[model samples]
Target chain A: MDLTPLFLPQSVAVIGVSSSNDRHPANVIFSKNLLRYPVRTHAVNPKGGVLHGEKVFPSVSAVPEEVDLAVVAVRAEYVGSVLQECIAAGVKSAIVISGGFSESGRDDLQTGLVDLAARHDFPFVGPNCLGLYSPGIIDTFFLPAERMVQPPKGGVAIVSQSGGILVDLLVKFADEGVGISCAISIGNKAIIRERQLLEFLASDSRTGVIVFYVEGFARDEGRDFVRMARDCGKPVIVMKAGKTNEGGRAVSSHTASLAGDYQVFRSVLKQHGVIEARNEYELASYCEALSCYSDKSIEGRIGIVTGSGGHGAMAVDACISKGLSVPGFSESIRQQLQDGFSASIRSIAAVGNPVDLTGSALENDFVSAVETLSITPEIDCILLLLLPYLPGISSDLGASISQVYRRSGKPLVAYVPHVEKYRMLIEGFELNRVPVASSIESAVNMTSVLRRCRPC
Target chain B: MLKKEIQNILDSSREVGWVLEPNAKSLLHMAGLPVPRYGWAENIEEAASMAAEIGYPIAAKVVSPAVVHKTEVQGVSLGIDSQEKLQEFYRKMSILPEFAGILVEEMVEGEELIVGATIDYQFGPTVLFGIGGTAVEVYKDVALRMAPLAPEDMSSMLQELKGGKLLAGYRGKEPIKFSALTEVLLSFSDLLMDIAPFIESIDLNPLLCSAQGCVVADARIILADQ
Candidate 1:
């Protein structure tokens, strides 16, 4: 199916627009595209008045120009007719933002829409979704723009099964200054599925990494998903839910018991080199890390340089649990690190795998340690546990670490606790392209993802 | 092309149940899977002759289409070193209503492993590997992949098992040759792919693996209703 109009429409019509009520979802969507997207916006209302100083046509067929796409935000009872009108008008595709279909015990309504779309031979998104976002081209999210946080434009593309989760993720991306090429919410997935989006995004020049929040897979699409993932030539990360009672609970046979639906799904995803994130934080962190360092090769071996002993131990545990090795530095690398530090700092610091450059350590101590470890042949990646509370440590230390990261060409992830005052210190590392995580565990998780990324 | 034995099995299976022993062994052998030397015996004298030919300390089981679990029905008897013992076991097996004949075969003792294929609702033609023996149901230690599986996939599937160390020669035992195991798994995957339409599932429980090689000790091929 050609998804051009659904994502990159030249012109869009918002059906069921309420001219008088500015807060209606259709009106908000109209206002949002009018102010931002380059595409021309057309509003349709049966009343056929003016909205935002533009004429509101009585229906999509009455629109002046060819409608590339239509956003069906009309009432549930009238959604099928609106889609019929759209089909008649020769609109290429649509996103049905109206709710109350399958999600609200209205299977008849949902089936009607599905049949209508099939008859028209056009692709459409959900009858209960926030719709699609194509960076600067079109965004059909009807939530008020003031309440939404837009992420900077970059390489990650997100496909979600739940709108609320997508919204939360976008806000997190915006807060972290992480950029996304596109974000699509595929609620109910009556027709369009992640597999379709995956095929489209695989060739998309803008998307370097693809992430999905999937509740379940459609009937036989799991195999195709795996095949596509293997051949896509891009990193695919998935967070699949509904495994508790996903499918086939009352099964017979040892194969059925051991290879239950979820277990097979998990194993297949892993076998195809798709990273599976367990939680929202891992999803966000892995996305950030992969987006920034997707081209860099990171082996599972890690070299840790920390300012706190306890945090260092925790980072070691976290990395080891995730199949990442934290090997001790060889004598030559250890000597170079020890020689680079000052005598007083050397007396207090532990120059080993988790090179604990203690609280009394100065800025040069971190710079030298990272520089030494980054050049070490045995080290594949570096984890910097930066504690701003250490009086000798400050935001300037991030630049030195970032410089080594650039020169060394090894992946680096920083962990800074969420101290209110340490915001700039965290940004200091982030602004330099060093992905920072809020906790040690998350940083290690991102490191594991980077290790799994296909080598450039 | 499927062998004549499997073609006949497919032609005759009218309901959803386990295929008979001769059909199962024939299909396994036709797919290039290793199985102990064996032959069907219609009478006690034939059973004793086959046991002697296969060389002593043999295992014998009643071949019945109606009885799916031979051990539960006391249809199986092991360690028959003499002709008298073999004849006695064959006579005991012949009285059962479902008994068609007796299967006389060489005995194989080694670490047990389970391998199987099932048509998953979501992902079709999935192959499985796991720890086996009587504890097959109790432990349920297994890993799965969609067929047809590659060599690396077979190795990783074995690695995923909880008792995976047994394949690597656990407890002073020589490591089972991985090349031989890989061939069995690859052939099993090919067979599942080939007859995917006619079969519901295939279970080769307690596949014996030792320093020498691996063999399908017991097999059950469940046919989908025609």
Candidate 2:
């Protein structure tokens, strides 16, 4: 199925909009899209009243405009009729934002929605979800626009099982300057799930990396998903919940007992070349790095350049523990790096695997070290642990290093503390396409995950 | 392709619901996997002759549907080096409930390892390789992959094990032929895939490995409940 209509819908009808309550989820979605997004928005309610100065059609078919998608936010019992009206009206797709389905112990109702959608050959996002947010195209999330921070538009597409987690990630992505192309909340997944969305996003021209926040998979669903990811031609990162053996099934063999759900899920993900994020931080770190550098070729070899020797040591330790190599610089490269540095700090600088240009080193020294490392054939990537608090380092160092990064065409990542004062420095690197992490550990994680996902 | 011999063994053991050691070993042997030379005996006279023919220091295991773990029931007697000892094992074990017969097999020793397969709920037919013995549960050092094993998966699974280095000649021990071990795992993978629909799980525990190659020292096949 072509998912273009679901994601890039030009016209949307918001069903269940209430004229009496502007705070209703359906009203919130209608006003958010009509006021901000580019998609043509229509409101639908049984009362046939005015909402936000627009005529509210009594049903979907009453809308005179051609509707590509319908955002259903009615009560659980009314969702079936609302969806039927959408199918009869020939709407291309729907996103059911209502909650009372399988998650509420109403499997029969959820199954009814599935059968209704299947019989009509229709596709929808959820029976209980916040729905999708395709930047500039449409926004179906019921959360009011002013309350949530919108992430900048870019390559990473997130498909999550929990809407709360999706909203949290959006806030995080916005705060971290991690650009996102879309965010989909697939609660209950009564009609569409991760596997289908993964296939869609893999072929999406706008999506460079795909991330999934999975709680569990149905029978054989995970296998089919990972197998598709093996050749999806895009980087797929998954952060799974329910890793513990709290609900393990009774089995009779060592293999079965040892094959805990998480263990098996993790193993399958690794075997199929999917990056498994162990925690939320890794998820964001990986998505941030991969969103920026998935197109670059990155071997596991890293060359660390830091203003503080302690940061360099920590970075080297983190790199080695993650199975990434911090190969020692060749004598000639070290000599060249030293030649580029001023005598004030060159004599005391440590020019080994992780070159430490001490606190006294100026911005020129850091940029020169990064430049030298970027051209070195032995170094597959560079990790710059920038300490903005240092005396000689200027804020323009981010811009200076980014210039070298662009000229050398080598992948570079920066570790800048996420302080308000250093926003300019972080933005300078990020705007020039170099990913910046808030912590040294996240910086190393970004480089390592980028290397692991280089093939896709 | 599944061997007809394995099919017949599975077919005959249908009523029992699980394949016993001797028949499991026969299934492995027929599938071209290396198993210790063995024979089944229903009587003391037959057990004595089979032990003599297979040579001394043989292991005798009880073949009964009701007894899954023979060692726990004191139904396993190792180092039965004499005809009298074999008769004594039969006399003692025959009194146990559901005592069907004795499986007489040549005793072999080497580094212990395990290869197993189970039909996972989601992935279906996953294979495991790791350190094996009575401590298989205690150590819990294993690596798993979806079956119909990939060429690279075999070595990667071995590499993932904590005791993988032990297989490459630990200390003064000679390393077992890796190609031989790979062939056995691949054949076992094929057999598991072929029988996955009918079986719940299978185990080739304590597969003794040395310079001579690998052997299935013990085997267990659990058929799916009807």
Candidate 3:
């Protein structure tokens, strides 16, 4: 199915908009799209009325212009009729935002929606979901615009099973400056599931890295999903829940018992080229890094440059624990890095793999070390542990180091404490397409995840 | 084709939910996996002669649908080096309910490992590799991949196991030829694909590996419920 209209619809109709209650999910979606997004938004209600100064049509058929997408947020009993109206009105696709489907023991009602959609050859997002959010194109989430923080628009695309998780990630991504191409919450997944979304986003022009927050997959769904990911030609990162035995069903053999849901899910992901994130933090770190450096591959050789020796040691430990090598600089590379250092801190600097240009080092010293390591043939990637509080380090340090990153195409990530004072430094690296993490471990995780996505 | 042959075996063994070890071993052998030289014996005389032909220091297991776990039922006796021991094993095993016969096979020992396939709910046929023995349950060191596997998939499965180093040799021991092990794994994968429709799960535990080659020490196949 072509998912273009579902994601990049030019016109949208919001069904079940309420004139009395402004807090209604349908109204929230209607007003958000009408006021903020560029998509022409039309409101629909059984009783014709006015909402936010726009005429609310009695039904989708009464809409003046052609409706490309329908956002249905009516009661479970009324969802089928609304979907039928949408299909009859020639609406290309729909996003069913109402709950009380299979999740609330209304499998029959959910099945009815599926049959109606299939009979009409129509496509829809969910019967129990928060719907999708495509920046500048559409936002079907019920959360009011003011209540949520929309991340800057860029390459990452997130498809999640839980609306709650999707909203939380949007806020986190915004806070971390991780730009997103789109965010989809596929609640219940009665119609569109992760596999279909994966197929769509794998070819999406705006999407460079795809992340999935999956709870579980139905029979044979996971197998198909991984096979698609194996040839998707982009980094597909997944964070699966239910990793323990609590979710396992009764089984007969030692293999069955041992092959718990999470174990098999994890193994197949590795067998394919999909990257598995252990936690929410890893998910965000991986998405942020992969989206920024999608074209770069980490071959497990990491070179670290830190202002503090302690941070370097921690990065080394993190690298080594993840099976990444932090090889010592060769004699010539070591001499070259030392030669580029400023005279004031040249003697005090530790010109090794995790080249520590001590507290007295200037901004130029850090840039020089990064530049030297970035050009070094032995280093696959560079980890910059920037301590902005150093006496000689200036605010332009991020921009200065980004220049070196831009000149040499080697992938670089930085660890900057997420303090307001260092926002510019972080932005400087990020704006230049280099990822910055709040913690040293997160930066190391980014490099490790990149290593997993090595091109075959 | 092996699929038709495997289906015939499943069709004939409809009464036994778990295919007997002798049949499971034959299935593996027919699929080109290495198994110790063996024969089925209906009595003490046959057991003794088969042990002599296959070489002594052999293992004898009860071939009965009533005993799914032979060791747990005390229906297995290893190191039956002489005629007295073979006769003793036959007498002990023949007393068990629904006793079919005795499966006498040459004993082989090396680093014990397990290779199994189970019908996963989501991934369907999934192959499992791990450290095996009686302690398989206790240690629980295992890795899995959806079958039929690619060559790279087989190698990665080995790398994922915590005890995978044992197969590569450890502490001055000669490493088992990875090609030999991978061949067994590949054949097992092909067999799994052929019989997946007829079976729910299969276990080849204690698949002994040495510098020489890998061999299936024990086999079990559980047919899917009708």
Candidate 4:
């Protein structure tokens, strides 16, 4: 499946532009693509006069020149006709952003569109979805720019069943400054499903890690997913929902009961080297870490360098709970870490495994400690818990820390929690490819996954 | 060897369902799986004689198409050490109308394990491994793998069982030879793969695993409808 046109389209046509209301979803998507994205956008309304000062084409066929992709934002009733027009106009890829299809109990409409897409052999995203948002390339989410925040462009591609969940995760990722490769809302999965997208993204240079938020799988697609993920050679993270209550909820065999379909799903995925995330937070954290340092592999031992003793203890507990080792720094490494800092910092901080740099520790203190452990044979990875409220620390410390992290080649994840005020420092770390987790638990969770991750 | 034996069972079958004990044991043995020594005895005297030859400790089970759960029907007698005991137990069980013959077999004592294969509705022939016994349904500590399995897959499946630690010698008990268990799992997977189309389900309930090696204590193979 050559999905290049679907993801990398140069020009896109929004098929249902409302003439009267600017609040219409189609118009909203059109305006977002026009103002923020690089793709050329065309508006289509049957009563065509103008939309956003660009001449609205009466139909897709009426649009001048070839369009690579079509965004079908019309009502579910007229979606099939618009698709036919797109096919007639030689459009190869499309995203059906309309609702009232299968999800609204209109199976006939969904089936008709599925059949139409099949006959044309062109891939379409969804019938009731937020649509595709390939950062810098295209943004088809109907939600307006101000309301729907977009994460910076990076290497993690998200394919989710719920559009609302995708938006929530995107907002969080944006706030944390986690870069994204593509965010696809595969609602109803009418035409293109997870397997096809996974196959496409597996070879995609832009996508380093593939994350799935699936409500359910279609029959044998689960088996196909496992096979493809094994061969993809990239880390695949799945956050499967409806697992606790879905298939085999009333099973007969103890094996089937204890190893329910969900357990089997998890085991099979893990057996194939796919990381399974238990919740939305872990899914996002794993995506951030894996996308940033997909090339590096960590093995258990983590070096914790934090500004506060309380945060360091919390991180240690989290790591230990997940079967990760937070080994005490060796005598030589400990002595080196202590020597790098002045007496004021050393007297206040604990020079142990969860190396507490104390509240007064400065930027150079953090850099030197991390730089030493980065080369230390015992430490497999590094975690920095920075609380910028301390008078000695400034956001400028991010640049120096990021530089030291890059030079070390060890997987480094930062946790900077407070609120929106710390955005600059967080962005500074993320800009240089260091993912910042929201909490201590998630920071350790990401560390554990990265440690177990073996690059194929 | 297995192909010829399976063909014979299919040719001689007048009805479908559980394959008879002799046939099931023959299938297992042909696939290089271990089964306790036993024979179909024609009479009470023959049952006693077979038990004496197989050794002092043995068991006798009534084999009949009407009785799927033999123990539930009170059709099984265990620990027949002497001829007097064998004859006495056989007299009580052989009177049942469903009794086809008496199967005198060696009594295997070890940790109970269940190895089963089913034609999954979606993934096709899948093998299951877990602790066996009546609590098999309650303590559903099992793992499944699509057959035929690789060597490593077999080991991992065993390791995944809730009772996996028992095989590794828990407490003061000697560990059941790991290679022996692996052999049984691998052979079962191969057999399931071979007869997957005709077989609906194959269960080796209470497949005994001990320091002596693994052996099939009870075996049943359910055939699919033509």
Candidate 5:
């Protein structure tokens, strides 16, 4: 059995809560977020009581509740005794967040924790780590994220070894209005590692796409994780770092990790069906698309609709970069676009595959071109390029895209520059059960990644 | 064949090794190899007179168990045309603290090749044969085959190297009898196959290729006798 209770805890006990400067950083912040979660929380501290208006029990056993997960924030040297109390209290899941374990090359304390964990069959999160936050279960991250973090619900689940990278990715997604099912920061993996997590996530219904940021991988461990994801038939994208020798050595020093032969890692990833991402943004956008539209089939071609000629060219380049074809319209469809577009729109567009809907194009003009493209049995998908700064846009772009989205089984994904204007458009697509995106890269990545993961 | 002879040496006296280079080559010559004619000497007078008796324009080199590659330490002198040069050569070679004795020999001329046999810890005894003049190791154009290899295998191993092109009359050169070189490689292979357990390394470097036949010019055999 997996120690998922460690991450998906219904009742939690925060072991070292305090308002003072010295008590760990995660404790002070998580103490407030825990109040929002529907959980029986036991705040353990002898000196402080009623933190976040919750009673502070001296120890976990005295809390008089079934503690599924225990977050220990005591001193590094005193963590072993805290774990001993957790084991006695029948705490099946424990997240050890304080640093200075085996990662510091201190042998004895690390060994003690490992032995203590094994006898009781408890899984650990980290000795130096930012904890898990599963948005699917409303398990928000403990890092004062409430003020800025708007959790978007979709298919993507991310597991990062670096906590800093995890937070940074979340912020990036928030900036783009892209959401995730779960974001996990598994630092200094004292007990749980990528392999076990991959196997467990294979059975999870909430997670459709799994993205990871890796600096290094141990010989057999990372290979096993890839194979598990492949067998589960989920798209796994990795932003594998350390492509150079010096970068590889740095990866080793950072994680105390053995960076296996890079070619071997590449070979295994290919054989087991994992996609290597180009960067963090693409990695997130790729998984976001996969998780959102895991069932859709992007046959072979795309129709581009843009406000300017430059955006049209950029969209064509994006399609070509993704190895997707921009199949042209039939002669009748081209004439229909010529008839639908005004004189100003007709002068700029050569009426090719990337039909540049020139400036002054209105909501009716957008609707007419899409109606023409979608009705054609020739086109497979539509890449709707919307510039919020453009004129004659119906404040109802969200409703218009949703109508086109449902009328044709072909997917409609958009790229918007104005975040405020497109927020409701994104929500409108979600309401109509049509997949939408915020960035052009995200749109391209999502299409390619989803098409690859759920192939023809 | 040479295989049966080496088998007799290993079976009879496998413990106490014939340790030094000269002693080991004497054992090889006794085992039916055409080793170079040489006389072992102690002092300068004996070495020079031995070189004179063997004839002028001879070679004088130290024979030592401690010294492995003579050229590495400048331990050998070739073409001693006079008694003075021979004595001087003896003075430099014999006085080395590591040197065991001096070998005064008549220098023979023709083509030269190296033949070796090594027992691999994993694949067992292996034989190697290739070009050998002055820079054999530096120009590592060689071929190897598993030991106890057949005569045909030895011929094929020779054909495996680009250096073996010389044995076939390279660039307007007189071919050093192909049959003779093949015989030397096969015999070396037989030697390794027969000795098996007790033998660790064998080197017959500069196996001179003459108009008549191929003869062993110098040899060093290391025995793991313990």
Candidate 6:
């Protein structure tokens, strides 16, 4: 059995709800939403029924219809009895959001839970985790999945082994404006391995790009999985968890797995065409890039249009870092970009591969320059760099810049080289399906990821 | 003792495939494994006398260790019916590279087994085993285990093969002694473990299994330190 109910949970019983505690709202929030989606909702408590006017079932077995999912939010000791009732009633999935079991170094409970999960064939998500959401069906997100679910699902699917970390990434990606197809919190992966989910995602049309958060993968099985990703023509970006020396040990505790031959894994990943991300955020950036190329019909030579000389120079530096060579600027495209700028801003130029349009280049200069650069015989994609407050630049900016990028349908990546200026720019591009990174490092890393993803 | 002598020989020689058998016997002598008593001769007269001393039906092999796969060169004569055959084997042994004297010894009788280690391109050194001797290629049953192992692990490894029953003396014969096997295994491990990085590989094929004990009849060790 796929343990269908745990992920696609229909009715949920949330244990441990209290009014006095601040974090206690977690049970109520999920319970309220589970009721709203009209999944059979039960408030399991010894205190009696009637929380938000719904009759509470004293135990999981007491509830009438089949309980698809049960969220055990009590102390770790009480979790066993709660699970016993669920198993007795034949509940298929359980999301154990309580802690102090294995992570606490406790033996009996942890081993018992492992044995229990295997016997029932009921895959449990986490012993300590932020629960997931199926969007429209249920928003059981502890980190507030509703605010994080940005509209219009493009084709980016996620199979994250880390529940807490995955939720953090989901929130960040949602805030950045990239919609998710289905982000799975496949905690521990005691039963369902990454390869099986990868195969499932490959068959799903909703997934254009697959971002895997791997703490560990079975040794030789990884090579076959990478080959399968290539066969499907889906860009699989991996943010491997065990890169650090400390992360290696932590991976064993997080998931019972051995970190094997990282250097050899990297070599094999390259051989099978898996794009490796340096970090979690960069992995997300690569996924977004592939999502655009897979779902949208955006293509052609790139144009690096920028507000400052540093911004343009930084983009060029990033392009090289990502293993991409800047398209040569012919005399005709060069003169047009020059004409789009003021005479003073155009001529003091340390003129080169990245058309440095000087600090005086405003929003309109960006729009005009991109239009002229796109018509060039050389450029196929545009890497647009903009600083939020250029000395003479207007504040009403990104709207006009957005129009030009939107009109061309040419892939334009926008970024503000400083961390503080990144938020608003990220939001602007987030709405447009264009990526806007906050730092030179993130922006360059994003482009490098883009170079690996072929826009189908 | 002979291993050290072989080392001195290897340390001096700049050629390859030349020190094949004698060099192997030297390694076996150093490891304290049982080896055949033989005489090395510079001439056919010397080879005939050595064969006579070894008694009738002695094994006479060409002395050039360079002649790997000696049967390919018509360089070996086993159970020689006469002194004339010993003279013929001695003459052929002289033609091969680094040709020394001939070896005339009483050949051991029993099942032959192959024990070897090959350096894999990815996973370092791997130890291999199978039923051996000249007809070994026919059975084609082999087992492999990673190296740098303990003596205790070897028995578990021995038990893995389907032919373990036969090795343990099936029917009426005595079981292939683990003590004899352990000695060779410990010697093999020390040769690999003690030298550190010097050895790249070691192949001991046709490790003769006699009624008394196991004898390393032929072997090869490739050095990496050079």
**Each prediction's interface RMSD?**
1.5, 1.2, 1.0, 3.4, 16.3, 15.8
Q: Is the docking of candidate 5 incorrect, acceptable, medium or high quality?
A: incorrect
All DockQ scores? 0.60, 0.68, 0.78, 0.32, 0.02, 0.03
lDDT of 2 by residue, B66-173 (tens): 888777888888888899999999888888888889999999888889988888778888888889886787898988888788889988888899898988988988
- Between candidates 1 and 3, the lDDT winner: 3
Q: Rate the local accuracy (lDDT) of all candidates.
A: 0.86, 0.88, 0.89, 0.83, 0.69, 0.64
Instruction: Tell me the tens digit of each residue's lDDT in model 6 across B143-207.
Output: 55444555655766576566767788889887776677767766665555454345555667677
lDDT of 2 by residue, A111-219 (tens): 9899999998899989889999988888899888989889999999999999999999998888888889999999999779888999899889899999999998877
Backbone clash pairs for candidate 6 read A300-A380, A301-A379, A301-A380, A301-A381, A302-A380, A302-A381, A302-A382, A303-A381, A303-A382, B168-B175
> How high is each candidate's TM-score?
0.94, 0.97, 0.97, 0.88, 0.63, 0.59
lDDT per residue, candidate 1, B1-226, as tens digits? Answer: 6667767776675453667777788778887999999989998778878988999999998998777778888988878899998888888888887778998889998778899988876778899888887678788888888888987897688777878987797788789877888888989998888888888777898798887889899888877656
Sliding window of 10 residues with minimal summed lDDT for model 6 chain A: A251-260
Record all residue pairs in model 4 with backbone atoms less than 3 Å apart, i.e. clashing: A154-A180, A254-B140
Candidate 2: pairs in clash: none
Instruction: Provide the lowest-lDDT 10-residue window in model 1 chain A.
Output: A245-254
- Residue pairs clashing in model 1 are none
> Which stretches of candidate 6 lie above 4 Å from their native place?
A15-40, A45-52, A74-90, A99-121, A134-158, A181-184, A203-208, A218-224, A231-233, A244-260, A295-302, A339-351, A395-397, A417-428, A454-456, B1-226
Error at A266, model 5, angstroms: 3.8
Model 5 lDDT at residue A347? 73
Evaluation by TM-score, superior candidate among 1 and 6: 1
Please give the range of 10 consecutive residues that has the lowest summed lDDT in model 2 chain B: B1-10
